[model samples]
Structures are given as structure tokens and as C-alpha cells.
Target: MKITGSRGAKALALVALVSAVGACGLPRSGPNKAEIFKGSVLKQGDAFIVTVNSRVTRATAVTPALGFSSAFRNAGVVGSDVISPGDVLGLTIYENVKDDPLLGNTGQRVSALTEIQVDGAGYIFVPYAGKIKAAGQSPDGLRNIITKKLDTQTPDPQISVQRLAGDGSTVSVSGFAGANGVFPIERPTRTLSAMLSKAGGVTIEPAVAIVRVTRGGKTGSIWLEDLYSNPALDIALRPGDKITVEKDTRSFVAMGATGSQTKVPFETQTLSAIEALATVGGLNTGTADPTGVFVFRNEPAEVANAVLGRRDLKGDQRMVYVLDLTQPTGMFEARDFLIRDGDTVYVTEAPFVQWQKTLSAISGSTNAANNIATTGQ
Candidate 1:
């Protein structure tokens, strides 16, 4: 370990060069504590950085409310047996005459009429009954109308009408459903939950599955599981309604020195900071600075005002929340802190990491110099 003046000076020179290069730049997962603070609102930066506290956690701990609007909730259950236009009706006529029957041959007192489709104008035609409105009329109501129409023509005409298949009282189901098709809305499938069951239920995980209902140009969505927990969410189905079962598209970006950096999806309806971190495999034990955990989000003006206690900020405000896991209540705050969709969770590297990298560079440089000198000798 004894080095002469020239060799010692050369080593010192190499160390200085490495230190200068390290000071200039070093690879990092993301901006460290100092760099992040430099971009704070106080520093005239775009982001407003605030330390995570009980108030901050409470202010930001919110998930989107997944439920139906008044239009969807206020809709009353429809009668599944009600007739509508485009419906197929099966009719059978019974005659009391022993001689000549209006709809059958002599001695034959019965006549069958299959596929009597209701027109777009809600009219259905029987042989002698003429055009009769069938839409909005129940099967029995239509039967009575037909009998009355044929009363003056046939001998005590009796009629029976039955609903067979139709494009009217049916819903179109698509997306993650087990069976994606148009299903008839019958007595058993009159409600949202029942209709979903008729479609073979959702194929995705229920915890994150979303059911969207579109009716008359208005759309409402709710968590598929919420349909059971909240009875109001299971609204009655209507004809021409479109239903889609989709997986939750909400996700957060995981970056910096923690686990893996990618778009982490929401596993549950509501996600917290702790859960989000866990989803990304937690922090990198060696490089992650426990005190430099941060979350970046663009919050609405209303939420920004509540969090920062300011009313002047308008539009979407850039918010950066700092979490010091080393504090006594830090872990609790993280557990309570909600991670909204499109948020980012980042952890800075420990300060000593840069120094270690600098030292490694210097050692590598010195070894290379020594090898060159030995080779020359």
C-alpha cells in the first residue's frame, strides 16, 4: 500500500476527475428529493409540493363515485310481457259454427295463424280483423281486440294471442360478458343484475369489473359488484338498452426506485397509496429513499383548493405530495392516502447511492490505468 509521490498524485487526479463527473451527472430512477423540491410551487415551479399529513391524506383520499344518475335510478321497472312494435305474435282462432267458419273450413272450428308480426306503426292484421294496434297491448288485450273485430263477421269468434320471438323487448350485451349477444328481456331478466346473469355474467374479476348501461343516448356506469351491494344500482332493464361489462380502466404510473415502473392497474374499486405501492412490488429496499416517496397528480380546481386551502387556483392543478416513510405516522398516512386514476407513485434514490456510484467509477478508472501500466512494462 506504499505509493511514491507521482503514483499517489495520479490516483488523486483520477479521483478528482471521477468526483467532478459524478457531480455533473449520475444515473437515477427519477428526480431525487432536492431535484423534486426545486420544482416546487414555492420555487416557482409548476408543481405544488406538500408533505403528506392527516389533512392532506383526507383531502386527497377520494375515488370516483361509481353509481347511476337520477335518470337511471328513477326509472321504474317495466312489464316484461308488454307488447311493442317489431314483436311476433302467434294467433289461434276458435269458431262456434258447425257449418261455415270464417277462418277455417266447414266442420273445422279452429284456425292457426303463425308469425303475425307487429308493424312499425304498432299494427297487426288478422284475416278479417283489419289493421289493429298491437304495440302497448298485452297478449290478452290483443286477443280481445281481434275477437271484437271479427265479432260481426264470424260466428262468435274467439282468439288467443301469444308472444313468440321479437327484436323489441331485448337488450344488446357486449364486452367482457360470458355471452355477448342480444337477449330477450323476459320476466326473469327484467332487471340489470338479472339481465347480466342471462348474458352469463361478467367474465372479468368482479372487484374491478364495470357495468355500463346506455339508454336513450344517456349512459350510466357502476361497479358490477355494486349492483349487489346497492340495490338501487340494479335498475330495471328496458327494451333497446345496451349493456357492456368492462374491466376497470383506471390505473396509476409506478416509477423511480421502487419495484417496477409501469402502469399499475387498480385492483379494487378504491385504491390507497400503500396498496398502490404494494401493487408495484413495493420499494427497492437498497436504492429507495424511505423519506423521499412522492405521488404526482393533476387535481381538479375544487380538490386543489381543499388540499392547499387556496381558492385562486383554477383548472387542473399540478400537485406533488411527499411521503416520509421514516416518520412515526408516515406509514399510516400512506395507508390512508388514496391513489386516484392517472396518478404517479415515485420513490427517490438514497443520497449515498450517487456517492457509491462515484466511488465505483473512480475504482474502475484506477484499475484500468494500472492494467495499462503493467501491460506497457
Candidate 2:
């Protein structure tokens, strides 16, 4: 009886240690990441994804969400057409015939076109027009001013004012452009695409190119492809606007029981959830919980706060979006659902996988106990 008691004691001790270790080694149900980020979990159908337009109505003081088309238009260099300092003007004056000096005029029909530059003080000096304010003055307005002034010295003096572009307005295009440099804006109605083309076109593919524009300390970006898709957004450029073309290398990570766990690049401007899953090779048939497809993202601060009706949220606050691919509607919805930058697509293991793991743990514990029993005897 004493020897039997000793064997029982050894078996119990092994079982306790094995149980403790197994508990420590096991993975949790959801990703440990969300907990680490202290984010909120949102099941599908529980809350709607706040879109750009909807954001305007729901906003309570966070940075307004950027709409897809508005990003291109709002960031694009556009404003009232007005002349400014550093603009070059072509001036032409007419006088009565017989002034005859530069043209040895038999009669003054038309003088040679004179090029004038707007001084930093916003003034332009012309022979007859003399010290006229060019900046903030329209081409037609300056023409009238010059005509009125020149008429004092010459008969019915007519004047024409043209904006000489070379020395005037220009835009800077660099990064991923074949020929990166300052491109002169010839027409007042030059579009973003035209400016890029004038700078030797883009070296990167437009479909995946992220074009960023910066002006007056404000910056915004849109995919080159998306910009072209919307006609209203292809706005005119303003002088001094900086356009930067960069590769759209943004990606999302896929983990859990997916067929291939990897970081998938967007490759294009927009990617739906279904397309994202397909890009990462989809879920593993043997172990994936089809019902547990989840996308973890640090949603826009405004969107998260609106959904939670909270004060404020961190930029890194994680939001878990569940998808049930087992149903047809779920698949359709996934097709329309857009995947954003830095999102994580995770598919949890099936419930049976946990059972299998539990059984394996039990088997290991039984073997450990048997080994302890033999040693004890």
C-alpha cells in the first residue's frame, strides 16, 4: 500500500506540472495584438463602417475624413485666376506713324513687343505705360491702364498685355518622374496630368502611384489612377505647388490559418476584402474557421469615435471587423468592402482545431505520468 501510494503521488505531480505548462503555451482566441493596442472589437452587422460622406454628418470635431474624389480636388492647386509678383508680361504699344527710331517708322503702326517683368514690389515699368501695378491686376485690366497712359504721347494708342509664362508661373514635379524638375505652366488651365506629362511623364505605374500635393503647409494624396477616374478632380495647378509621385507600396498583413501568411501590397489604388484575401492566397481549408474571418485595422480616429460615441480615440486604436464568408451575402459584402493601408486580415482556427490541440495535450500528459510512474517504482 505504501509503494502504490508513492506511485500515485508521482503521477499527480507530473499531471499538475504538465497542465500548468500547457495552459501557458496555448494561444488565445483573438489576436494578442488587439489587446496590446487596447482597441475595440466590432462584430459584423453590429456597426456600420462610416464612409467619407457619412463622416460629415457624424463628425464631432475630429479631423474630417478625406473623401476619395475630394482628396484629388482639394489637394490640387486651384484658386481664382490672378496675376502675382514674378510674372513676366509681354507688352505691345501702337502710335501714330513717323516716330521712326527702333523701326525707323514711316508711320507708327505698331512698336516691337516689349517683355516686362513684375518687380518684387508688384510694379512693372513700361516705356509709355510707366510704373503700372501688375500684381493683383488682370491682363485685360493692365492692358486698359497701358492704353490710357500711352494715349497721352501717341494718337489713339492701343496696348496688349500677355502673360509670358517662361519666367512666370511654374510647378515642381519630382520623385518617380522620368525627368524631375520645375515645369513651366503654359496655359492658365493646365491640369495635374498635363504637368506630370510635361515633366517627362511618370516612371512608376499610374495604377499604383500615390501622387501627393503640398501647398501652404497643407498636403493631400490620391492614387494617380483614382485621380484620372474622376474628371472633376483633375483641377488646374497653381504656381509653387509641389507634386510628388511615390510608389503605392502600402500593404496589409495576413495571419492565423490563412493559406499563406504574408504582407500583401495593395498593387492598385483600391482593394476589396475579397481581393485582399485572394492576394494572400486565402484561408487554409484544413484549419481555418471560415466563420471567423476578421480584419484588424486602426480605423480613422473620427470613424472609431463615432461608432463608439466616445470622446476621442488614438490613431492606433484597433477595430476588429468580422466577416462570415460561409454565406453568399458575406462574400458579396466583402467584395465591396475596401481594405485600407496597414490592415491585418486574420482567420482564426476552427473550433475542432482547439479540440485536437486539447487531445494532444492530454496524450502528452498521460505519457509524462507513465514515465514518472516507472521512475518512481
Candidate 3:
């Protein structure tokens, strides 16, 4: 069949019109490189960068129960006695007697003034009163024995015992503070707050502020929130007590299709999957393929195999948990999934969207070439 020039021109015009329509059907591409669809598949190593915007919010703030009780039991005695060696005890003696000028009121007068030294055996040496166990004894208890011994030698004598040296007065302050060391509590009554003040207070950064108290070898952990909310937990300080404010160590990494691709600090030991998502600004709107959200975490090989069918060949390798956010039920389940420390969250872009963008670009180039050719003729 011999084709006419006008017919050929009409056919070419029809083909161009059809191509333009098909190009119009192709998805428009802008700065956004990814799209969230109902059912999108993702492959490993695909990069999707999340856009930064003020509208995006993270779930870094935690509102835990204020009245959470500590696991420590109140077993120790209140105001327990603590005595150590090298403690000096001051003793004074008074007596009632008439004055004899030459003898200096020898019958009933203040005769002996002595200071006792606690030896290594926890015993104190006193004049005329042999070794006395003063370590566990109260002031009055030791005075009674000294007075009795003085009575046998002389008349009735009154003895007073006082602590003048404070060698054993010390408390340990540690953790998220400018200064962490063993500080001596100069005051008779020292509280936990006072110790923190002396140690330069808590760290200004919330990510590193955590205070823990250990008294007489017992451990108790307290959050910075508890320090402000629950004052009752911030109890008074005692001798031989240690206060530590440890820097928070648990954190999650947010990367790939998140506004902020960095480590997010968490106060709690474990963070929920939904909470982690929120911390990363809840995925990029135009670029994130929610269905491709995944979390990569390291776990024990045995446990990983039991839970995720992963083998031990990788030797402590991380397990990948892929989450399909397209399904309505995925939202609920995602909330239950917990994220551990060092876990990485990634959101990918839809593959078809990229194809559509490529097709659109190719069609646009073809149209530009056609227009240039027509203008040149």
C-alpha cells in the first residue's frame, strides 16, 4: 500500500499526541525521590534521605510513672553507727573539793585531762584506764567505764567525752558531675543534695544526667526526673555512702530517610519501635516508603536463630527486621516492637516511583528534541 505524505504526517502527529499523553500519565518528579504507596517492595542498600522540616516531631520526651518504687528493701538500720581507727576522743574530769593552796585542791578537783587514741584493734588507750573498746561504743557508754575506774583511785569523778577530730568524716561522690571524687562531709549532717552541690551539681546535658546512691555497699538508681519530681527518693547522706551520676549509655541510631540521621539518646533501657520512629521525626513525608521501614540490630547468634531463623555463621552478626507499614495491623504491631541499643532504623523509597520518574524525564527529553528539530526546519 502506497502511503500519502498527508496521511504520514497525520500518523506522526497521532503518535506524538499518544506519546505526550503517556508522558502525562508518568509520575512527576521534583526534588522528592521517593513515595509512600500502599504496597511497595524495597531492596537492600537502597538509600532514601529524609527531608528536614520543623513540622516533623520526634518522640524523645518520656513521661514515665513518677511513683515507681525501687527494688531495694529498707533493711538497714536508720542512723547506724560507723566508727573507724585513729579517731581522737577528748575527755575531761571534774571533781568537788575544797581548795588547798599548796596541793591545788587535790581532794575533789578536775585532775586529769586526756585525749584517747583508737588503736588498730578498735581499742582506745586511756590514762589509768587500760584498753577500752571504743569502736562500737557510744560516748556515754565509754565515759561510764572511765568514771568508774577513776572512782576506785580517787573520789567521785565526772568525765565528759567529746569527738574533736573528723578523720573518718568522708563521702564518695561520682557520676555526671564536673567533679567526681571522695569528698569529706565537713558538716555533721550532710544530705544527698549537699553532696551533689559540693561535687559541682549534675551535668547540664540531660543525655548524661543520672544519679545513683550506694550506701553501706547497697545500690540504688535514680533518674534525673526523679530528682525533681520525687524528692523523697533523694534522701539524706550518710557516712561510707557513695553517690554516682552515670552518663546515659543507651541510644538508637536514626538513619536513611529521617530528618536527622544521628544517634538519639534514650533514658530508658529499651525503646519501643513506634517511639524510635517518632524520635527520627516519623519518616519523610514525600521521600519515605513506610512499607520499607526496617530495623537492624545485633543479637546473640543462638537467640537470633531461634527468633529470626538466622544462622550462626556470621558470628554475632546483626539481624534485620523488616516492617511493612502499609497494612493497618502493622501500625499496632510496630508499637509493640521494642528497639535495643545500637539498633539502626532505615526507611527506603518505592521502586516504581523511581521508574515513573525516569520515564517522565525520558519523555520530556524526547519532546524537547522534537521541538528543537521542528524549529530548526
* Number of the candidate with higher TM-score, 2 or 3: 2
Candidate 1, after superposition: displacement of residue 106 in Å?
Answer: 0.4
Cα lDDT tens digits, model 3, 1-377, are 35688899888886676566555655432222233321132333323222211111121212322222343332332232344455567877775445531113545465544566667667876666667777656677778888787677555667888754544546777667768887765453355666687888877564446777776656676676657666566566655677777776778888766666788888564477778988778977766777777776665555444453336444564455666667766776577666767778777756555565665666787799999999999
* lDDT for position 284 in model 3: 74
Deviating ranges (above 4 Å) for candidate 3: 1-75, 78-81, 86-88, 97-120, 177-201, 204-241, 301-317, 356-377
Winner on TM-score between 1 and 3 is 1
**TM-score, prediction 1:** 0.93
TM, every model = 0.93, 0.63, 0.62
What's the lDDT for residue 326 in model 1?
92
Instruction: Evaluate residue 174 in candidate 1 and report its C-alpha lDDT on the 0 to 100 scale.
Output: 99
- Scored against the true structure, residue 148 in model 1 reaches a CA lDDT of 86
Please write out the lDDT profile of model 2 over residues 72-136, one tens digit for every residue.
46554443335677877787766655645332266657776656778877888877456888887
Comparing 2 and 3 by lDDT, which wins? 2
Best by lDDT: 1
